[model samples]
Target: RHGMRLDAADQAWHLSTPTPYDPPLTYGGWNQCRALGMRIASLLDAREQESNAGSGHSDNGTKRKKKKHKVVIHTSPFLRCLQTSVAISAGMAQFEAPKDRTSSSRPRTPSQMHSASPKLPLGSQKRYRKTKLRVDAFLGEWLNPQYFDHITPPPPSSMMVATAKAELLQTEEVDTFTPTTTQRTSGGSLWNGANNRAGSSRESPLDDWSHVTNALLHAPIARRDRSNSASSVGSNESSGRKSPFRPKSPFRHGHGFQPLTSTMPKVEASTYYPPQPHYAISNSDTIPRGYISHARVNTVNVDYHWDSSRHLQEWGDGGQFGEEWSSMHRRFRRGLNGVMEWYSQHGSEERGEDALGLEQVMTHESTDDDDQEDLVVIMVTHGAGCNALIGALTNQPVLMDVGMASLTMAVRKE
Candidate 1:
């Protein structure tokens, strides 16, 4: 779980450290993730069969070589997501490779496997070891200042990898409680009565993150100086009565979306007035929700309900608060595009690995075969990032209410 700081008066709203699952995931949650993994595995198996069928033997009786399919999984830097990805990976391992491929010596049914836990079958482990899992920092939860009551930084990369490994270890043997040994002994339990309940109920013990490298660090807190605040530019008392130019509205879409330009100045929220108790103001003229008033209206606060300092920190000194929206869109779009490009390039000719360090193996395409190469890319991210991904894939800016552990699938059109 992540936390946020929403104190508007506090300019440098800091992001807290990520917290592990309090009670830990229920059995049902584990089952759902495992099912998703199984589904993905099944889909890949079917695709392999299609490829094999389409590729007829050469002039000799020898079988034609099939393209090597690589499965790349990208996950958010969050602890919970990393845990879920491990479960899904284990579930995928449960699938037996095709019999004709000489990968599986014997077939094992559901009853023969340990479906109750996230453990991979002994044989299946070796079969899918090459499946790559990488943490993509951009895939972390959305950094919308207005939406969060408390903002938490992502887990360090090493810690995240360790958590995933720990989750995987849990499936090695059956246990009533899924939390690690450290988690079990660290804190008090929910039931504090006659039974003298054990195990941690709130926070899990912190891991030794000293050696953790590649920590996914977010924007640093901005300065608290009010002189540098956007409001100062408007308050020019030398000869001015009032600056006619107002700051642009921060909303990305709908009633008050005033686009930002090079000439426009940034705006900071001065005060926030909570909604009034009374609904009607008898004879008084009231502005409708989401509507902006035009008559010398200094009431428009671009940083309304938003921690503009966070955005400023992310974008640097001269950047506007709303700039984060476009930046995020570009980040996600590039990531998705890179994944597709990697897939397309690796399917045919071999090339040197990219900056991401993903190993690209060469594969020969059958001249007579007309079928396209298959690629499986799994992205485990937070709800907001998921929405951003959807927006990027569809080339439309959208905001969707996404919940925990929700799954979204997108297919690129040929």
Candidate 2:
């Protein structure tokens, strides 16, 4: 207390206090402790008042603090730093010492200010040069992944790709075989995509591919001639060929259709015309071996047959067949294929002088059959209603004697 330099005014103010002052300490410790306690209490308070004579009066305590500036603080910034550090250390000690904050709550002082606080990411200390420098270095690798990581391209979506055009065109052909117009199978040429392959027709690509090799080598004319000669040779050798599968010839009208060998051969009863080089309805068949041919040509197989009564009612004595029927039958005959006719003789007047049959085989034509069989004879004589059987043993007609002399023969050699 004695060490503190108080002015005369301060001494008078202290003497005027209502509280009785204790006697000074043996070593003056009591007065010094009281003075220190009063100083600390004054700093904790928001305002200081001088009782006998107060000189300052300012709002919000700013003027009061200025007037109480009797505190000759060691005011250097270094001293301020030191004071903050000391106060913070003392508070930390109190905190670590388990002082109940709720009971004797006290304000703490802040210390150790850096340039700035750390930003968001881990290890990003604002004071650490490496982290700050790395943050500043980051460019736009965030926005574009392609620039960051390499990527292989993917297949285009359907909407993104345009389709290719059809490679083949369906060109028509003249069925030189049938003397009629024909067409080539383009096999859905409009869409030739690899993904569009379907069942059965998937083989079309394989077949077409085989043709491509030959197509690359041969010119049109050379290919055409080759195809013709190959076809003339046979069908098996020309399987992979690209040339036309058909050829033109008015004299040839049939295709690969052969007479049904598995069934019985019917005897045709019409005005039949044996095939001629000039008026061939169709081409001769390429018959396979072991197949016995049985054909009925120029004769239509119908459920209802023309009876003699109907025939007589139409044109009594004109002709056995009507004119219109004759014309239609002729047209059908002309357009018929593989037409065959068998002959029977009963006085050669055939059924009433007008009944007709197939023309005879040309004498100059060469025949394939080597051996001739026994002639089978059948005749409707002027007699009772009955049919007779002929035996190969004696070349004799059984039951009735209307004999074998009138029958003609056509058969294969053994």
Candidate 3:
């Protein structure tokens, strides 16, 4: 998934997803999930060895080898989760396959490829069973009853028409810049006006609003960042290493701060409040007098009616955007507690059975009565869900945040 932004009225908010539009994983997201799956498989294999080492001796002093366990994979019903499970399975399969021990310089022939399979690690004749991944809807993102009336079915395909529109907007440029008066009032009115005009019954208007907002506000930021980076940097004359300073201007490339120029439109301080000073410029020792710094700000303007449906919360102090801090904290805490309760009862059991079955299948033997296996649960969900879960588990408030397609892992030892 990639990053996206929503625009309503004159205010815009940014959102990140595993896919550009929704419901699907981007190529990067897919690869990251796949690699994570492989890593999990490797960890399981290592754990299996530890289990074997602990139980290698019988009561009568005879040596016996333990079987490798089976892997049971469960995923959320979301399209991205399903896709991630598939990638992970592929990674596990690749991990299970024996590697060629020949030198990297040597090219393997068909005969070499068809040579007798390598002996099992423990001199056993059993083959590892493939991991079976299952999709479960209950393990999905935390759904607030106040927000959604019922569970929505997954879209037929993750591919979105809006994705095409977004791409088109990325390539298209808007030359006509209409300067509007920036009032001191909280930007909530911008979204309120749009929602009032569009009506609550309509969905198309909201989609259009988000699309147009992305095009008008988001696209420009992306384009400007890309352009500034390309323009500020050039190849070094002697050594090939990237030079820290640029030749044309002393300012760092893509720093988001630009020198005030005659060509740029003048801002009326009476009408517009320039954004808070960025730390980079504010902390600098030698300040340039004529330079004006531009800091990227995401202004979320959600309709009052859809407050329950929206997942965005006021972060940190919450005073920055005039959002109610207590309300957001309560909501987060409730959602997290609910998820933790569900996971403790169901998620733990499913993961244990699946992982044990995988071990048994791979080693072609049942687990010993005394052998306890470590369980690994991989959950794919939204940012809020992830944050809440982590906070609950760590017994701390949510402080760290993850980006789109980011992987977070937790382990439980027996």
Per-residue alpha-carbon lDDT of candidate 1 for residues 133-242, written as tens digits (9 for 90 to 100): 55555555555545444444334333444454443333221112335542334242122234433432323222322122124133343444556644454454334754
Better TM-score candidate (2, 3): 3
Q: Is candidate 1 or 2 superior in lDDT?
A: 1
Off by over 4 Å in 2: 1-295, 298-373, 380-383, 387-414
Model 3 per-residue lDDT tens digits across residues 122-219: 33443333444433333344333332232232222112222322221232222222434433323332333433322222222222244444464545
Q: Which candidate leads in lDDT?
A: 1
Decreasing TM-score order of the candidates: 1, 3, 2
lDDT for 64 in candidate 3 is 62
Q: Candidate 2 overall Cα lDDT vs. reference?
A: 0.22
Q: Model 1, stretches more than 4 Å misplaced?
A: 1-26, 57-63, 97-130, 150-324, 342-374, 402-407, 410-414
Error of 2 at 275 (Å): 22
How far residue 243's Cα lies from its native spot in candidate 3, in Å, is: 78
Worst 10 residues of 1 by lDDT: 300-309
**lDDT score, candidate 1, position 206:** 26
What is the full ranking by lDDT, best candidate first? 1, 3, 2
